[model samples]
Target: MSTPHTRRSFIGHAAAGFSTLALPRWGQAQPATEPAPRPAQIEHAVTAPVAIEVNARPIPAFEPRDRSRTRFGSLQYRSGLVLTSPHRGFGGLSGIRVDAKGERFLALSDQGSWFTGSIRYSGRAMVGLDDVEAAPMLNAEGRPITEKRLWYDTESLARDGNLVYVGLERVNQIMRFDFSKGGTRARGEVLPTPPAVRKLPYNKGLEALVFVPKGQPLAGTLIAFSERGLDANENLIAFLIGGPSPGQFSVRRTEKFDISDAVLLASGELLILERKFSWFTGIDIRIRSIPLKSIAPGALVDGPVLFNADLGHEVDNMEGIDAHVTAEGETVLTMISDDNFSLLQRTLLLQFTLVE
Candidate 1:
């Protein structure tokens, strides 16, 4: 297990490698002109889905300094890729949902665009992506959702069968889309939330979402977590919407980390992917495992750290995570990074197997 102090020490050791790097401030807004015009502009021009070519380069090792090492905490590194595309609206991926077979995937950008594709795999290792397409998220009026005021910072995503939920951080709102209607072309409607959800601080609200499906502890519930929303006790505030116990709860805050993305396992464990940034340390990412049965309204939940990585490992602004079970019963976790469309950053896809 990694305590705050131990993690800090690890970061300090990794600082030397990142000293010359100028990393983008994760989650902060930048000028549209700075990043070759905002992605929304490019997406807006795309009224319908457009096929895009995404190029992927393999990451042969998780830690370049230790190529032979495969285990990090409770996870075993499988493979990784550096993803790039010629499409201007391709980066800034903040959320993703992978299918049960770990092939088909649906991802979204903070600029209010949708990306759908399938992963090409060699046995259990990811080799590349194929048949990718990009489209703008449409409103009920069939216009781009970015057309709405303060609606482009779409940060979180959750899926239940054919239904998809998107959380916009700038305005602290969630939108519901029925994929059965039109897939990524589906028009979205606002999903009403608790009053406090709308009151979270701008830029720090609605960062991660997890939809608990049938047979789970919080089945039929959409769990929404703020990036840094704090309660009276200073714990991270989260909401349980449209469930048997629909209300608020807190996740015990530790190590100054904020929630980035989350996934609910079939075995009833909620795996939260979190990250923290500092001028001295660059970026650090980790995963925590919380028992789903322990979550309830007004409850303060905590979990054990299952994995941890720093700039020492292959990582960027990691923001999305999903898990699938192999036919052999192995649980595999996939993670994606939000590049923020900055030339200084990169979009990375990584995978690991849960060893615990």
Candidate 2:
């Protein structure tokens, strides 16, 4: 019934409005400093996964490929819907934010480190040009552009308010922008890796941010988490830290929590997704839970609720996680996979109901 738009078709319209899709006028150099290495090799320590016996349910297995809608970097869920799309500059899709009206807004983070523009979803998952574009300096092209690399392994959006946060993995900083009034402006900032955190071995960089509910034991404190370790192959549980501000973070070497795609729950608990790779190829996706208060630098992580997928079933790079309350007042957890645009990857969006 519908035909997919090709690169030619996508760019043809841009060529008409030549002034729109312009490159960033200026390019900023990344911070020039080598990250400090961890003191010693982290012993391959697997903390006992804490049991998260939720009402277990499974979603269809996702097979990612290196096509259009395959490379997923980060994602979010607003009003119980998942937003999955491309992240940076390729005329592709950026991230998505579901609004209060149950409408999905396409967000572009071409601000380099600042905030950019947004697009509104029209039918199904596709959006119209009029959806976004009037915003200030949103994209590098000065027009509506997708496929942007805001940061590596990170992207963010907020619901119930005009708050937006983006993680700059390279510099390990989180830029906070307020949409409450309008126009994206940096209201505050936080550096994920403090001087001490930079000392961790293979601290490639920090890249995940999940806000803990205020009033909870861990409320008001932002959790600056990361997907750091030896190599991309070897498995490493992400680390979590409580920070009231960027430079000032709660650092305790002893408390380490392991969870894949670290996400915080509505109840102030942290949901950990474990990606089990098959001996040969495929990956098994599982879910585990932990209380926000249980996260300390030295606190050992034990017990994890296992969300089911096929064992050894591989997809693309699975990153980004967000939880929302469904219209029925039920809690739902959704996930998206990063295609990486690699011949070996595909964009996958998986959803599940949390049974605890």
Candidate 3:
């Protein structure tokens, strides 16, 4: 562990060493000018899977001002990385799924692209990445999903064995892919969803997904959560699809946070990763642990906040979360950020140990 003085000294030296680097400050004020027209969305249509080089810079401490204090809420800081890639299509990572062994990872950008890679670890601390590849998400006809209008914005991801489910926010639809067929090359078919799902508010719909595996409380269920789709009672609307009790439920929304991603733990806990942006405070991210058994048709579920962080911490647009148990029986939570392809934002990958 790094001490505050040492960390500060190292950072000062690093700043001096890299003073010429043009990285944008997170919340610096911009010069006022006439608003520019929004540019057309960049399409990351890859003909096939292609390897990409990504650079990872180690973040020695989560809270730079107090490096020695590792414990925060119900988690203990482990390691983190500030990830960057020269590839133009490399950001906007909305969701991620890590293998059980905490090695291989599958991630997707909101621009309808797949990023597959493995985490290189040195004694449980992430060193960097290896074997990273980028590919466009394909549709039923083997064409890039982004080739269609309003078919991108792939925000949430869930995995059950070789089967993968992705939730697209722009169209409020779910697409299924079988990795066994061709890995990221597998074409996605639109999964049938309830009529209400298509009625969710565009851009705010279908932000988080968790697939309950066999032997779980809601086994064989695809749990979907909207970013801010609210019910008449003002709670966030969620759905249980293809489960024994397939219906709609509500997640009690508080603190102005919206759902970004979620992971269902083997311990019967549903951890929802949420974030909220404010001009006054920048951005804030949090994790709430709700019991899996408490969710059912028409049930209103709520949980205790397990963690929270703000811009004062080394955070950006924190968007994705996943967990894997280490050999020592420690549940390690991994988080990734979506830069929104903006110079002022960054893509951060952070990890923590869930201290039960």
Candidate 4:
């Protein structure tokens, strides 16, 4: 084993207008944002697809806590695997989403690549990935986002019907893609997020996005959260956009955990994926649930920790999450990690049965 490196995360630059979103380095006032009438249409062209491929290897053991395969909290480990590709643009996958059937998956990298693939199963356990394809996240001009700008660090994703919303962390902006027409080839139009969102610290802003389904309590509401965006009082901030209610709320920060990703359950409960890093502990990840009915303006939302794991287990910088239902009516939670395109880190895909 390699010696665990001891280091703390450093602050990054803010968005276009703000000096800082949470922690002020220069101390400046934040500008307010005027909400647009709705999502503006993006005029994007179809670009030639980039050639990409992936290789998957099997990991036989599902349980990482121990040899017993005992359940931990409400989640049971299903399987996990590391993914690699010869394509140089691969890795840094910070956001992910899956179809209702759990078969198809889409993940976006901070490096501006889109990874699409399907899950392959052997019996009931996940065995590998299939039909994997990687493409650049195109800009409004139909060129790769990285080719367009340096700040296009795609980090979080939320989907409702044919509309998909992707969060760019370093730039502190949200881009909406209308897939009802061209699918992944759809042009991306910027969404009018709150001025506070624009103030979030670069590389930590807008880490999680979840859209409540029509039947949910907060139906049609779009929820966006920061990785560690703190208020003057040091409360973690979250925004409720669109829907019947639109406002800001707080989520209590504990154990140095920051939001990595989140998914909404059929029961209207929000499952948040949080992570922590330390020289002593290396890395730690957890899942916490907050009731949708509890999230309101200025509400301090907190919930029981459903699951937790550390570096002793098979984990890296796990950052993306999505949920799907099985034919047996079971809910399966899927997660992915951002390798940071580093040899020291790995791109991992893990799954577990959510037995709430």
Task: Provide TM-scores for the models.
Answer: 0.88, 0.53, 0.87, 0.85
For residues 94-182, what per-residue lDDT tens digits would candidate 4 score against the true structure? 88898888888888887666778888887767777777766666678766666555446788999998888998888888888887767
Tell me model 4's lDDT, rounded to 2 decimals: 0.76
Q: How close is candidate 4 to the true structure, as a TM-score?
A: 0.85
| Cα shift from native, residue 148, model 4 (Å) | 3.9
| Top candidate by lDDT | 1
Error of 3 at 121 (Å): 0.9
lDDT (Cα) of model 3: 0.85
**Clash count in backbone of candidate 1:** 0
Q: Write one digit per residue (lDDT tens) for candidate 1, span 215-308.
A: 9998899999999999998999999999899999999999999999999999999999999988766788999999999999999999999999
Q: Tens digit of lDDT per residue, candidate 2, span 182-227?
A: 3442233443444644543432444455655566665555565444
C-alpha lDDT of all candidate models, in order? 0.87, 0.39, 0.85, 0.76
Q: Which stretches of candidate 1 lie over 4 Å from their true place?
A: 1-45
The number of residue pairs in model 2 that clash at the backbone is 46
Q: Alpha carbon lDDT of residue 169, candidate 4?
A: 86
Q: Write the per-residue lDDT of candidate 3 for residues 1-356, one digit (tens) a residue.
A: 54443333334323432333221111123346845333321222234677889999998988887888889899999999989998768888899999988899999988888999999998878989999998888899877888788888899999999999999999999999999999998989999999999999988999999999999998999999999999998999999999899999999999888999999999999999998766555567899999999999999999999999876677777889999999999999999988776554577899999998
TM-score: which is higher, 1 or 2?
1
Displacement of the residue 239 alpha carbon in candidate 3, Å: 0.3
What TM-score does model 1 achieve against the real structure?
0.88
Instruction: Tell me the lDDT of model 1 at 214.
Output: 90
